[model samples]
Target chain A: MPESSLRGALTEAVLYILLALYTPLHGYGIMQKVDELSHGRVNLGAGTLYGAINTLLDKGWIIPLAGEMDSRRKEYVISETGKEIVAMELIRLQELLDNGRVVTGGTV
Target chain B: MKHIVHKAYWDYEKEEQWLNEMSHKGLALEDYSWCRYVFRDAPAGKYIYRIELLDKTGSHYESQKYLKFLEETGIECVAAYMRWAFLRKEASLGPFDLYSDIDSKINYYSKVINFWNIFAAMELVIGTMNVLIGLVNGGRYGGLGFNFFLGLPLIGLGVALVKLGDPLRAKIKRLQQERAVQE
Candidate 1:
């Protein structure tokens, strides 16, 4: 991956997570939302979500909800950084879809 | 009601499976030391177990914080022995793993290798110290090689750990590179 793409890969888990976190959500909640948002095509595993959450936290892309330290169900909301990353990734994804459309031609 | 099982230093997968199997046998893991597993009687197949590895010489603060984080996610951190943590939760839904994707799983493997490196370094140091001490006391105690021999197990453990984790580390690095280009 290019430096940009590496940073903006927006893997299914990552993209869905960023989308889910647009509204503050807990781990399970995010998992559920990812599944629902992808229309049952993607089922975010707990382990995958857990690791992505940690990575996002490390990058300061997400922050835990207030006083969630001791709570069994902690919530996280996307940060400004997360929003920017999502925006950039969406652009890359848009380009991909556009290029695909061009290569296929407007037959239909 | 209880059983003590001795697990090897790098037997995380087997240890996890064993714990889950024990849970199926109505023995829920309550705690564990380096090689000793403590269990409590429970309904068969009631609990799921997972193991998370930490850096061998992990700090108490970091370990506690991570464990607390796991707890917040509804996983019970039942035991901490050296660099490994034993986590469990109700198995009503199915098995719950702590790392699922290739990248995260690679990271998990890397942590194991890192801990092994730490353990290997510590073993090498301890072995060197033991040999040095044994040499110094050669005439006084007539046990010149005993301390060195005593340290052999540590060195062996270090070697075994390296052997255990090095492959995973290499695989992760290669995968990362290939994945980078593919992406």
Candidate 2:
């Protein structure tokens, strides 16, 4: 039931975060990646990032790195589920970009 | 130079805005205690202040972990009061918003409602109890007029809390409906 909700649906912040976590990324690193990924267009706030991280973790889309426990600085990686979401999101984005190019006269 | 500003616990948005306004006037928050805020002279437009209310109670470890996380993002914790944490960052680092998305914003609003609803309920409960006891005892304690007057303020405050919850709950519902449609 919950899996159905993950179909083609993710917030912009969550999409960027999943895209950024192709490799292990720390909290701060995720923020930087989002900023870099968006080209400084979408500023991810600390609180919003924290909330998104928690939500993804709850959804089993991301997992905490082992041996980092006992310390507040934890790292995360996109799980298999998270990767699937990323793939879905990428296809969705590709279609959007394709439409833009087609409508905007061959420019994306 | 220093300025002391007093604000209630429920006025966090106003407090954040006021702190930002002060920073714009070349005054950065040095410290604050209770309702009084202490500010010192600093370069104008150099800092951005943010506040987050801790939702969990009696969890020092959780709060510390949150603070540590904020530090990693270049936001430094300057002060903490009860469940509220005050954080600051150099504006030169660019703009930062605490809750950007609707769902996250709803989470924040729910936390606030949890805190204030409990407070307001307690006030109303005590106020009613005092009036009832006073009425039963009659002149043995304070006069009826005295008890009524004393309870009046508490009742008024409880009404204020109820008013506060109405807008917040409506916002939560609105966000939930919008999210439902999108999903």
Query: What is the C-alpha lDDT profile of model 1 across B1-183, one tens digit per residue?
Result: 676667664567777888889899999999887667788999999999988776442348867756655665567888887667788988875447666456766777776777668878888788778877677777577756678677777677767767777667677888788766652
TM-score of chain A of 2: 0.85
Worst 10 residues of 2 chain B by lDDT: B139-148
lDDT of 2 at B145: 48
lDDT accuracy of residue B173 in candidate 1 = 85
Residues B1-183 of candidate 2 have per-residue lDDT tens digits of: 887777665567777898999899999987877888888889998899987787653248888777888899888887887778878999988776777777788888898888888889988998887777667666666557456667778978987987777777898999999878662
TM-score of chain A of each: 0.89, 0.85
CAPRI classification of candidate 1: acceptable
Q: TM-score for candidate 1, please give it.
A: 0.75
Top model number, DockQ: 2
lDDT of 1 by residue, A1-108 (tens): 566545536677788899999999988788768878988666665656776888899989999998987776789999999899889989989998888888889453
- Locate the minimum summed-lDDT window of 10 residues in model 1 chain A: A1-10
User: What's every prediction's RMSD, in angstroms?
Assistant: 4.4, 3.6
Task: Output the number of the TM-score-best candidate.
Answer: 2
